[model samples]
Target: MDTITTYLDSLFASLPDNDKTRQAKADMLANMRDYYRDLLREGKSEEAAIGAVISAFGSIDELRADLGMPAQATATTTQSDPTDAEEEADEDAITETELRSFWHMADQFATQIALGVLLCAVSIALPAYTGGGRWEGFGVIGMFLLAALAVGLFIWGGTVFSQQKKQLNDRPITASAKQLANKTTGEYTRQFAAGLIAGIMICIGSLIPPIISAYIPGFIIENAGGALFLAIAGLGSYLIIYVSINYSQLKRYAYATTAANSTAWYHDGTDDDAANYWEQPHKHHQNTRARQDIALFHQVYWPTVLIIYLLVSFLLHGWAYSWLIFIIGGVMQNIITAVIARRDYSE
Candidate 1:
């Protein structure tokens, strides 16, 4: 039995290592052993039974057809081995420089999120300062400055994020290495928690001054306290946004790298012989297309909402209810995204 299994292993050496090949090997080896045993029971000598079994096994060519192997792999070696090559390519491992680059980009992405929170904060404070017909000129000037800063930060953050994405798409680091970094980087998680804590504290602390000002009974003091409260809330929200977005991007990069590596292996033609190009590769591309479509929807939808908001608020002077458009658009966006996701999954 040992001798027969050894010979079977040698014969199977050239075949792909997959579920089908494994099962076929087991079936063939079992049949060969059974035939040998039956020959012995029929009064044949050991040597003759062995020789008969060896002869009956026939050529590797016939075995290949029986096992349903590809015609190109006729020898004890494949033209290209995806698994071996991929493992070799990761020999250099991930460098500290690559990790540093990812962190920098994550910080930049976080900065953009912070800027958005700042914009919201400024907007919240602006009306209180500008609306009561007091210091109207300075209030307008402050509003413009904050708005300009917010817009500038948003643009800068977008550019930085784009660069970060391009670097990932280029695959500067291996997927395994990225996974390792994510595991080792306790700082990302710590920072996320710290940011959340600080944001919550500031938000809670900001309420104290307003509560005291409520008893003072002066418009200036009360309004000042309200503005201070809004500012504090905005800063807290910004901190939360900054940490959360950066953490999410870190996760996204890790997953993207892993998926890309797997896709590359599958495309190498040796890793998955059981699946045709369409069954696996086409489905991946279909997912990519679905994501792109959803992204396009967001790109178009948000700008349209902004345009609608500005036109209605400035031209039609419907400031009170114009904001509902955003709520409606958000609901529609969610529905559209869900529909797209479901349709892709179904197909």
Candidate 2:
């Protein structure tokens, strides 16, 4: 099958790439596959079946003549009629298979990242559970394990995105493909809205325990309430991320993959800034790397801060001052966001 595909590619290498020619190539490949299968069913050797299929196709010219496709034009095409040139450029456009693979990878990446965040947020509260004395050791171990998992997820998801972007950088997105991706997300809109609302409510409701504990004296719900706050916030973040996936920008990304290479795409002088959004391998990689850096900081910084805060507040009995660390961490996070934006994608 691979050999047949290679042969077909070589045969049509010089032909004008347009809808009719694409249809013809598809038909030819199908016919070749059917013939090869028939030969195999008739007890022909694999080599013989392949050789017969190749011989049956004859030359490229013969194939073109048979398919009623015009012969490859030798003359330089004028700029006045850009249709043929535009059609030709779409030969290396993104296919349905690649798009599906991207979406699948994206979904996996999102779930892993969200889970990582959840684990990080919950790790600090593990010591408060299953008794306090020696189980604190268990909490430390749990925090280490969860942090390890979160780092691993960050690396995996970042690598997945970077590699996918590399493979798809030089491809264009077709109108049909764009529409299909848009429709796919559009179908889930109502569900996403409901889920979004529910997640926010869950986050808001997490504070109920603390508020109730203020009124009813002896329950001792401080740790539980704090843990609930982190857990619910993390869950709400996961919900927002999972539902807010912007699949439509995939088309723009596909085009931007090779925007730096002038020969790679036809500019035709329209909306140049928008067309040059992330600028191919170099700048695209910078943005991707920037994101990885930001994620790493979040994965490491906040969790470590939370662990310190929990230890000081619970064990050392420094709840009054330890809460200040969060404010510092939040400010640092905002700094990271700003730095990445300026360095990678400013104006």
Candidate 3:
């Protein structure tokens, strides 16, 4: 148990400092450790336990796929001696240099996210201010500016998306990796656009009703208008979560693609049988199946929430019940998605 714990610690310590990556490594290590410990408890000897652990670790290809990381170098250089595990641990500690580099990259990403939020907020708010609280006038300008901002954000997001995809597709495969990459990239783009659309819809939906009520003489938009806006806001929030999850997956795909390509390039033409490209060990880890499953789940999940909201509205108070259900469903969906993501991507 002591030896296994030490081995696991060293394995995790060597991983890079990105939160997702680190969590993945830790989960993998923990799973591996438990498997080995179980074997030992079943009367396996030290030698047998070590061999079993190594075998269960599987190929680097499987690890990369399961952990949602890009393929790196092969396992051909792995150490066999149990003592070497401790040594690997000692060498795994992050250097100051590596930490600095990681922090720099993180800072840049944070800045970009902040800027995106600011742009979106300003774009949505500008029309209301310019329209002087008039519904019709505000709606037109808001739609234009919001749509423009959405397009701009989409373009920026697409650039990030492409870069990530290229990273994954660095090596040429027998069309499978490329095909998978293309599909995943397309899905991600659509999800992002959906999020932007939802945001625009929510902002417009919320503002328009209030403005209309204010302009009309006998109309009371406060109750119904508030409820509609709330519903829209709920939908918009769900879209944000939906987009983020897909984006994260896209990033993982990119990393995996890059790693697979690097591995393929390293071993190029080493054997004639390996020339199939897609059949290569590195390419085999591509998660086309998993991505499809996630996409299908997302499609159903959002619509389910919407339907529930609508049903609740009809069964109870039209406006009030609808918003209540929408808000509740949005919160629940976010929680479920977070759990699934952790389970799927972690180790």
Candidate 4:
């Protein structure tokens, strides 16, 4: 019993500095130690006590199960080929983890794309709807509302950025878990900053077209307001593009982190059964392929679309068409960019 307790203590001492894993190990060790000590207090000889402890404790696989890890084997009374059962269990559990990681990757992709589309829609629609000069008081109210919303978003994004940064800076990325933690922190911070800056710029740029129209000559001002609106709209569109690009890049890193964390946890928990999971070896290759695919799409498709849209709008010589085309193109561009962005990390 004393020997068993000493063995568990040594194993616990060798575990890496992961808070949840460490606490779990500590609790399991303490429980085993107490149980064995109680056995020693009975009239058993040390050899008998140690044998009893070994039989009851089983192996690391049993300890993992006792600690509430997902059971790797079915409870079959026929103790035939327990080794095969362990392999099957490992395969099942690792597949579940991989599926979870895949779903999480999809979620991360959808979120960034949705946000980008929303930003484009809001930026384009706000100026066009308010440009007609009919809703005077309502326009002022809407501007304030938009400003408030932008500020609120910025504050939330900034908070996430700061927290992630602190977590990253405090830790050393010397292991797989630490590396994942740092990568996640960096990605979150980048996305938050991109969204924050883009939102503020769009809000401010949207207001410029209306304000400048009230000050110039009627002939000069008519075209001036529309031209200035288009210019600011173009700038806002560019900002959305920038945000989408950065968001796509950041989301890729986030996927890598999630995959790494899952792999690390699997390796840490599974003693000899870790070889069954395919996540660790394939992760890097998958992410690299994803990045290359995204880059190819971005480089080949986006610029051609943007150029054609701009050229057609210029040749048409109608303000309404120009405005409509710009708005539609901007929104479409953002959506396309967002979709491709997820592929950046898919490799």
Candidate 5:
């Protein structure tokens, strides 16, 4: 009964915690307990009784609706077959740490993309507003202000990423699980075509300002430049949104084997059977090292780049060219990464 309660808790843990939700969960749990006990009195084994009780318990969506809660896509899914439903229920179980990791990734990408757009827009707007009396020196001040904000946001995002990694690593997944199947090549190809079409639409939408400017004259061209900056930012935001949506969709593909069935007790004794279920050799080591190296590079590289941009902008008073340093740094980082990967692969 304790194990069953724990399992139910895991299922609902991702939802928002509140009084009504809590009471609804408690009610459902009590009903399940009653059903479980009834099955036990019918002369069933403990395992079968528990399984039957769980199987009889319906989807949480209807319950959530009755509780006046919004529909949640992350809620436990259902299947027609009892066995498959049980398997899916077990697989979809996720810890709060795992959910936090997904949210962090989404938030980091969104923040970074917004910052990129803001920096680009300010770069355009500052120069356009500079020739006036009141704003003569404001360009430099505004640029520095935006740069500081960007740095703070970058640091916060980095911290979130670090916290997510630490939390996930500290609590390892020991559940003996069946690895979920990846999407087929055909599915990926279809998605790629759809994404490309979406990207084209985004580009077309972004070019609307320039298209409009072509019909107008004079000072409007400068306005068109600002529009272009916005368009670039929009494009970036679009890509991030696309990536995040895809990531969320992909999460459904991964299912974890429940702890209750991590290992088969009736398996024939063998040396190979003693190996840990989650263990992978070379690929695991390589992936871990890759993630660590990438994280380290981002932590060091961005802060160093931000510092250099600030120094150059303030000392040389070259706001126009100083931003190019970021582009150059990005290219260099890619080159260095490629070279290191090649060297590592060779060894």
Candidate 6:
């Protein structure tokens, strides 16, 4: 439905906004929706139905004449004598430098968040390593102290990142990294793959210490195993979160089209693949909606998981592999988001 609306917007963009035009536009949209539903009833795929609707839209120029409006000016005339308004719009478009400076900080922000989480995990182990009895109090105090420091890092990093996003914002991403940086799409894809593999490996390995400790038969084995598991799991999470968050934003910009974002640094018409160009606007819409939904989930989910983790780790005296809770939570979050996105956008 959004894709249909977006296409309708493009078809009517040049027309004046008034009572008759609005009525016509609404009628056109209704007709398009009816055709779309008929195609669906005939078992056509959503993509095929949308394509058919757009292909049959014919010429907006004819509609303009019917609406008592003048025909569009020739491209040659507009190109030869572009208006001041057009020049001002071009000037107002976001610069690549501003984009690079602002968006490239995702990695930094991810690192800060991951490191803070890792520190909290490490803080849990301090009490175990410091021994039992009265000395455990000191270790517990140290745990809180480290946790406090980790919280401070989180606050500071989040503040800076939020402020940057709020202040440096402009148009959405409009071009691939090739237009802004030296890296290619293949490079980023490879990087994402490598990071994913590494995170999985680390997470898998985190199970090793606890498994071995179970058979070793020693008192400290449990605490040591738990500490090791937490640390390793935290490290794995850092890699996954760091790469996923940064790569997500990077990708949104990389494949964005001029129709999706106003800041088209180097979009000339024939350069981009025709199919890719047509897909961009819809992809942009899907990504924006999915990102918002996932972000809202993150706000509630991760903090709650952290609180649960802290209570469990503290109460259980460093339960071996307790930190696996985090890894599992992340996996669940990913699966949930993936399912939601597929179900929501599949139509």
Ranking of candidates on TM-score, top first: 6, 1, 2, 5, 4, 3
lDDT of each: 0.60, 0.58, 0.47, 0.47, 0.49, 0.64
lDDT of 6 by residue, 1-347 (tens): 79989988987898778765677677667667866786686689999999977775545664553344443323332243222323323343444565677666767887888788888878887886666656788889989998998899899989988887765343444343225532533467688778878987998898888788887777447777867877887788778877766665565454333332222212232223222333444454455556667778889989999998898899986655566777668656766766655553443
Better of 2 and 4 by lDDT: 2
How high is the lDDT of residue 160 in model 5? 68
Per-residue lDDT tens digits for candidate 2, residues 163-190, read 8768876455543344456566566557
Specify the poorest-scoring 10-residue window by lDDT in model 5.
Answer: 274-283
Write the number of the candidate with greater TM-score, choosing between 3 and 5: 5
Off by over 4 Å in 1: 1-99, 123-134, 170-176, 184-187, 204-208, 215-220, 257-347
- Residue pairs with backbone atoms closer than 3 Å in model 4 (clashes): 286-347, 287-347, 288-347, 289-347, 290-347
lDDT order, best first, reads 6, 1, 2, 5, 3, 4
Better of 2 and 5 by TM-score: 2
lDDT tens per residue, model 4, 119-152: 4444444554566677645655655665566455
Q: Model 1, 152-261: lDDT tens per residue? A: 87888888777766654524344445555667445577876787678768766767667777876664476677677777767776776676666655544342223333
lDDT of 4: 0.47
What TM-score fits each model? 0.50, 0.48, 0.33, 0.34, 0.39, 0.59
TM-score of candidate 4 to 2 decimals: 0.34
**Which model scores highest in TM-score?**
6
Runs with alpha carbons beyond 4 Å of true place in candidate 2: 1-89, 128-134, 246-347
Q: Count the backbone clashes (under 3 Å) in each candidate.
A: 0, 0, 5, 5, 0, 0
RMSD of 6: 9.4
